[model samples]
Target: MNNSFSPRTGSPQAGSQQVGSQQVGRLYGVGVGPGDPELMTVKAIRTIAACPVVAYFCKRGTKGHARRIASDAITAEHEELPMVYPVTVELPPDHPDYGRQIEAFFDESAERIAVHLAAGRSVAALNEGDPFFYGSFMHLFLRLASRFPTEVIPGVTSMVSSASLLPRPLMLRDDVLSVIPGTLDEESLVRTLRHTDAAVVMKLGQNLPKVRRAIAAAGLADRAWYVERASMAEQRVLPFAEAPDTAPYFSQIVIPGEGKRG
Candidate 1:
């Protein structure tokens, strides 16, 4: 091959400057919505369907929540990538290796996504809730944003979805709504729940017992309403005081606002 000039074009340039810039693939972190496919925004559907590749986070051997919610838009033609977590509750969140293991998993997942981006293939990652709100997709977005083109499409969060099931309004006048995770310590949970106008406690799996106790201690037991699987077909709604022996991973406990903004 010639050292530096385009033989056919006869131009005095380094391979004709690569004949314009190469097409770069766009990376989209799309929030698939709480649970129901109907809740998925039109923009989300278009963005997801436009991408040639779709990626989602899932437990080992499982298809994942977001993937299931967005199945209507994703066809068999699109390549699916499942970013399985290296560790879940098996190791405590406080463990030193816990962070390391998760960090490694995200790092590897980002690399895998990057490969597709480099290949000029658009990729969309499906997230259950809003992608920016405490979602696993943020880790990958932060890693790849600086290096490639990335966009985030918002989705309905479980906080509002769970609130919709209640007869009372989540907020009335100047009421504030606070969302807390069940992973918080009992003392912290009580403190936060006691001060908030309305509260939604999420990530309720094995932490249901502790969260139930915290809601009682915070004096919001009667006000609190427990919702399991917000928009799914098997959704369950009940009083927080009646928390069952077992709750699924997607449960939410909501305390509707009392309209005390006056």
Candidate 2:
């Protein structure tokens, strides 16, 4: 990948005459890494610094975490757009149609972003982890990639960072490391955990207790260490026995004992 920082210019659409002398704009999905600014890659920082507008996902009534992660790297003059996603108990494909609602929100957000792109302004949508790894910014990319020139800058993932915080290796020798979403059903969890020597269970908010039970039942709980908000100022790392039932969604459990290369 070309990591050089160069100004990108393009017209809004084919046959669309340029208004005044402004150039066309591009959309960038820049991963800000897990919480710590120092963890952000040099390429990500340069992209944010150069983009004319910065967009980030946030809960409807809460502050934007991604934006905060990239604040120091961005100049005050850069435009900030907080794209809000409603946080509710509505289940997917249910009454309020969670999927529909979120899809609509992404579409609308893309339209708003298109306005900036049309003006030839480069916009960078900040993501917490690798843009393509379960990050909300991927929704925007799906919606706008066909219509505009889009680029993704990958960032350090929390799972890897969390593993690094440990005293032991996540995977060893020929051991496999499975990264599973804690939302999986009990049976699925058992099957996956039984096969992998090491595993990183993410999205451990409301489903933490369930995951904890699954790991324990699978005889892997003792090997796991839970890390919440890894790399952040308020980071917490504890054994599975001590992890709280109400850990945040950002929490992850790393099982190191199962895999030792040395």
User: For this target, which candidate reaches the highest lDDT against the unseen true structure?
Assistant: 1
Collision pairs in model 2: 10-24, 24-120, 25-120, 172-261
Q: Each model's TM-score, in the order given? A: 0.88, 0.86
Candidate 1 lDDT tens digits, 1-262: 5634232222111111221376556778888889999999887898877888899999998899999999999898899999998898689878999999999999999999989877778788898889998887899888998776677788999888989999999998888788898889999999998888998888888788999889889889889898988898989999876778667878889899989856
Candidate 1 colliding pairs: none
Q: Any runs in candidate 2 off by more than 4 Å, and if so which?
A: 1-23, 89-96, 257-262
* Cα distance off (Å), candidate 2, residue 22: 11
On the 0 to 100 scale, the lDDT of residue 38 in model 1 is 95
Question: Stretches of candidate 1 above 4 Å error?
Answer: 1-22, 89-92
Q: What lDDT is reached at residue 140 by model 1? A: 88
